[model samples]
Target: MRIVSGGIQHETNTFSHQPTTLADFERDSGCGPDFSGGQAVFDRYRNTGTIHGGYIDAADVLEFDLIPLICAKAQPSGVVESTAFDTILNLFLDRLSETPAVDGVLLDLHGAMVTAACDDGEAPFMEAVRERVGPDIPIIATLDLHANITQRMADACDVIIGFDTYPHVDMRARGREAGELLVRMIRGEVQPVQAYRQLPLLTMPPMQCTLREPMQSLMQNVFRMEDEPGVLTATVAMGFPFADISAAGVSCLVTTNNDAALAEKKVEELAGWLWDLRDELQPQLTPIDEMIEFAATHDGPIVYADGSDNPGGGAPCDGTVVLRALIEAKFQNAVVGILHDPETAALAHQAGVGATIEARVGGKTDDRHGTPIELPAYVRALCDGHFVHHGPMNQGVVGEFGPMALLLVGGVEVVVSSNRKQLLDREMLRVIGVTPEHRRLIVVKSAVHFRADFGECATHILDADTPGIHRPDYANYDYQNLRRPIYPLDNVTVDFGG
Candidate 1:
């Protein structure tokens, strides 16, 4: 049997001022810079731990011909430019139309993508694919745990499998599951019936982590439900709340073997179980001052997750609130990593290693995060900022932050980069001569993904309540398009009838 597969992935933050463009996708896809279409897709993902990697493995095991097409992804940022969105969509559709007698399609999607043209990006993209493939073709998609699932997306695809783990360690696993299920459907071994529901509740990244409570119990239940007789699969997309779309909230989906009743029942049960814990889903954060004070008195090896300025969630990684406070307090042997400051990084590279250079670092994006820090920084090291992730999440994937410079600003060692990236891996610091394990305090500009790598050695992990677009505080966001009566945003309950 023959199958065609590819997708465009991005997690858009409406609150961010920088609009994502096609140029960003060319440079920052999971497959590396300027990668798209055909054999390049297989070459990049064949042995990797990404969604497409799982697809490749499934193709080898299931013995189905997997035809790869255009799969492009840009860093999480503001809404995509309309021209870029249309260009990629048309390219994907055109390729699908050109394919010969394809039996199925597998999409590797992030599911939280928002463009200038549409708030519900995945729905329309799937609908377009459906239009090209006709009704008989089976389409299965693998999504991030944080998908803002829409009913239209459910209607367009045959099966939707989402990651059960945050830090998203299960990308390849979920992809393999989707592929195996698709093969079953193609062989008439199992007929898939799906049930889906959108919750009237939204949540933040810190609490949505499957490694932590509420989510851990919730995902365990989802797994148990999947083990039941005739249940094909189950997904609990915590949803990307940073999106200002109407579908920006928690959602549940269940697929059963030709059993719509069972699918609906399992989905309802999942949604209700999640809804019951709405109050517990809220995140607790440490004030920057309190975190700094604790670091002063405490021993070594503490990790402060700077989630508010997570570049992965579309916040500019240059937030200076925590860095500025640490500098003023003279925090020593501490490392703050992967700060997005191209100008400062360039200056450090030009000044050479061991040279003390006057550099203005971070907080250059906007006023909401914080003001830029002006200080005399010693250029300790310089690197090309290319590294492979050895962590549980996105392991074997290539990551680039352009050129990077390690600057010693007062007692704090700051790693600045030309590109914006979340500090999720230890290799991100290690490449620039800063060892994370040896540092007294390590601040990562990430929400939860960092835990997959950094949590293993760190003595303590604290979530810092800083200022930026991705902050867990719901009040920081001004929601003009979101559907109201959601949890925390309002005191409301949901009764999604099975």
Candidate 2:
């Protein structure tokens, strides 16, 4: 029996000003032999020798012939450029063609991907791949817990599994599970039947952590289904809201066999349960000014999230709202990483460290959020912005910071980079000479995932209401594509499926 594996991941933020390009992917993460399986894909399943890592280690145990395809994952940001999309997708497809036919295919895809030209990008790719493989061959996929599962993707693949936990500790376990499930399909042990239900509500990532009550209850139900005989696996994806698509909200999926109808019924029941409890999902968020004030009063090692400007969710990481707030609040001992000013980074690299340089930073990409602030600053540290990740998501991962500089403007230390990516791990700080361990206050342009690293030793880890395309509120944006009258968007009642 043979099995094929590949992945393509991108979280599209409909409101980001910059177009996601090949250069962005290259500088942040070096484009190399394993394309589709980069930081998120490879790290999840990367195994050293122990029974551990994150997700990839478990895949090693399952022992499928790994055809590590070209995986192109950029920070969740604006619509993908057509050229960039074609390049990555075609490379992955070409690899699939050359790698030999197989019994099953494993894909790691971000459900909320949108291209500059096309709203539904995952469909065409899945349809194209399905057309080549034929129907009998099973396809099982793992998605971001926050994936916006589209109808096209649901129709093409036999199974779609999402991270049960929002903190997403199961990256390796899920991959191994998918492999085990695929092997079963090859051996004729289980023929999978699937069910999917879309919910009407859409909210931000900060409010969507599965560790909490609403999502926690939802995740527990998914686990309980595994104990049932006919059910092979159960997954509930909250769905990424930033991407403007027809299927942009929450959804629950069930992959089972004996009774497809029963499975679909179960999914519907769960979706309805979640829909009824939609108000509970809204986050108890902190104010941006309060976050700054706390950092000022606190002693050392605090991490504040400018969540609205998180590039991972497709917001222009360069938004100046929170930064401006910090400046206005007169907070000191605060260090900000990744303003994502490429021009400013270039000049700093040219001038070298210890060189005093004055430039405009932040709010450059999207003034809809805030205007740029010019700072007469000194380059405290200069780095190529390169580091091998030592974190859960991208362990053993090598990537460049690509012309990064640590700029000191009065009390604020601005970490600027040519790459538009989130500060997930300490390497983003350590690699740039700004020691992650030493700082009193660390501000990163990321959402929940930053907690994995910063959560430890952090006197306080909090969030800010900085402006960008990926605001937590669902009503702020004009979404023409999403199915009309869904959940929190309209507050209407409708039947949901599992």
Clashing residue pair totals per candidate (backbone < 3 A): 0, 22
Please provide the root mean square deviation of candidate 1 (C-alpha atoms, Å).
1.3
lDDT of 1 by residue, 1-498 (tens): 998989989999999999999899887765545446778888878877889889989999989999988889988999999878888889888888888999999998889999888999888889999989999999998889999999999999999999999898888888888888899999999999999998899999999988889899888888899999999999999999899889999998999999999998889998889888898999999998899888888876899999999999999999998889899998899999889999999999899999999888888889988998998999999999989889888889888888999999778999999988899989999989998999999999999999999989888899988988999999998999999878888988557553
Question: lDDT tens digits, residues 214-233, model 2?
Answer: 77776777688777778888
Local distance difference test values of all predictions, in order: 0.90, 0.73
Query: Given candidate 1, what's the lDDT at residue 428?
Result: 92
Specify the highest-lDDT model's number: 1
Cα TM-score of candidate 1: 0.98
lDDT of 1 at 86: 87
Cα error, residue 101 of model 2, in Å, equals 3.9
